[model samples]
Target: MTPFLTGLGASLGLIVAIGAQNAFVLRQGIKREGVLPVVLVCLASDAILIFAGVAGIGALIQSAPALLVVIRWVGAAFLVTYAAFAAKRALRPGILEAATAPRGMTAWTAVLTAAGITWLNPHVYLDTLVLLGSLANAQGSPGKWLFGIGAATGSALWFPLIGFGARGLRGFFARPASWRILDGCVAVLMLGLAVVLAAEA
Candidate 1:
């Protein structure tokens, strides 16, 4: 129970931050587009990574610096491109009538984008594969598996909360200006993250 609680708390601490993946999910939630698929992808990805970490793959990943280097560059490029799209949306805020607004992204596009955001970020690898893995391993054997389950549970709880709970903000987001502001913030965040990733590379 202690290991489980510890793992839950640690996972929340790491994932609660306003990173690229969270921002994307938030936007989808507000737009009410592909929310289920996007949330599921995020939760599933986190579970896979957390368990993989616990399964000792984290050490293998740590030994392969070249893999991370490639991921860093590719992730940076993807972020920049995403940022540009967000900036474009910000500049061209369309009429956002709750019942009439066009869907900004298809389900397939949202799923792919969510996957890219989750899988590409080297920071995610460090946090999940390295940091979480190391923490889980410290618990030893069965406890480590419990710890991994707890961490994955954290993701399960969070993604749905943020994704579905965001629908409550639909009234506020009905305003085009509100969308503009949200998109602008997302753009800045993506660009800033891209710059950080590039710097790290």
Candidate 2:
């Protein structure tokens, strides 16, 4: 039970931060477009990663610094591209009203984007595979599995909350200015993350 609680607290602490993934999910939630699929993809991805970590894959990953380097470059490029798109949207903000709102992403596109955002980030690997893996293993035996379950549970709870919970903000986002501010913040965050990734050792 202690291991479970520790896992839950650690998982939430890492994921609750405002990142590209969270921003994307929030946007999809508010727009009421492909929310379920997006949320499921993120949740499933996190669960897989968490379990894989507990399964001892983290040691293999640690041995391959080159793999992380490749991922870092790719992730940085992806983030920069996303940041540019966000900046473009910020330049021409639109209201969230159905009639005037821009065309939303299809379920397939949203799912793919969600997967990319979840899988491409080097930070995700570090957090789930390396850090959480170490933490879970330190708990030993059955406690490790329990910790993994608890971590996965945190992801399960969080994605739905942000994805479905964002609907409440639809009213506020109906204002173009609000959308502009949101997009602007997303752009900055994405760019900042890209810079950090590129500069990281």
Candidate 3:
């Protein structure tokens, strides 16, 4: 109970951020396009990253400064490119309607998209392996475990919430205005992330 409670709080703190990957997940979820694969890939990736943080091995991800530098630049590049794509989508909101379902949706595409968004973004390592791991270690022993559990729980809980929650709102979101709003929100988030990446580099 202690570990779970502690984990819940920490996880919520981190998971609340609406990043590019998350935006994609929510978008796909709203469209009900290949939900299973997207959720699986996201949860599996989260489990791996969170478990790495919990085991303390995530601490070693930055052992090589050169490697870290390379990852940072690569991450920044990806974020910028991805952000451009997101911006384009936002500008042309009808694309989301075209992406509707069946015709262009596939399980493998969702997996690849989620995986690319998760693994390709060095921000995942920076946040999960480095930042989250460091924070957990700071707690020491039981507290460390508590924080890790909370972080992991956040991932586990969030994927389903984002997936299904979107479904529940499908009726309201069917509006083009809602699509514009969602795309605008996603665009803003991706652009902000892109700026952060540039600053980090």
Candidate 4:
């Protein structure tokens, strides 16, 4: 119970931050399109990552600096590409305004975008593979799995809550400017992360 609770709190603290994954999920929720699929992808991805961490994959990652470097480059490139897209959207928010935008995103498009945002970000690896893994392993063998399960539970609970919760703010997003602001924030976030990753690489 202690390990589980500790994992839960740590995972929630890390996930509650506004990152590319959370931002993408929030946008999908606001659009009320493919929210379920997006949430499911994030939840499943987190579960896998967390379990991998508990299973000692982090040690493998640590032993291979070259692999981390490769991931860093790829992740930075992906983030830059997404940031450019966000910048373009921010420049023309009217196209996505709730009142004017095409009837939300296609299911496939939304799913793909969500997947890219979740998987292509190196920070996800750092948090889940390194940080969480180290912390879980610290609990010793018996408690590590419990801690990982607790972390997985946190992911399971967070995505649904954030995805559904954003829907409640639909009325506020009726304006085109709201979308612009959102995209602008996303652009900055992505670009900043990209720069940081590139520097590290």
- Candidate 3: what lDDT? 0.75
Candidate number of the best lDDT: 1
> Candidate order by lDDT, highest to lowest?
1, 2, 4, 3
Residue 8 accuracy (lDDT) in model 1:
95
User: What lDDT score belongs to each candidate, Candidate 1 first?
Assistant: 0.91, 0.89, 0.75, 0.88
Reference-based TM-score of each model: 0.96, 0.95, 0.83, 0.94
Instruction: Tell me the deviation in Å of residue 23 in model 3.
Output: 1.2
Off by over 4 Å in 2: 93-102
lDDT for model 2: 0.89
Expressed as tens digits, the lDDT of each residue in 78-100 for candidate 4 is 88998898888888645455323
Q: What TM-score should be assigned to candidate 4?
A: 0.94
The TM-score measured for candidate 1 stands at 0.96
Give residue 28's lDDT in candidate 1 (0 to 100). Answer: 90
TM-score for predicted model 3 compared with the true structure: 0.83
**TM-score, cand. 2:** 0.95
Best by TM-score: 1
Encode model 1's per-residue lDDT on 45-94: one tens digit a residue.
99999999998899999999999989999999999999998888777534
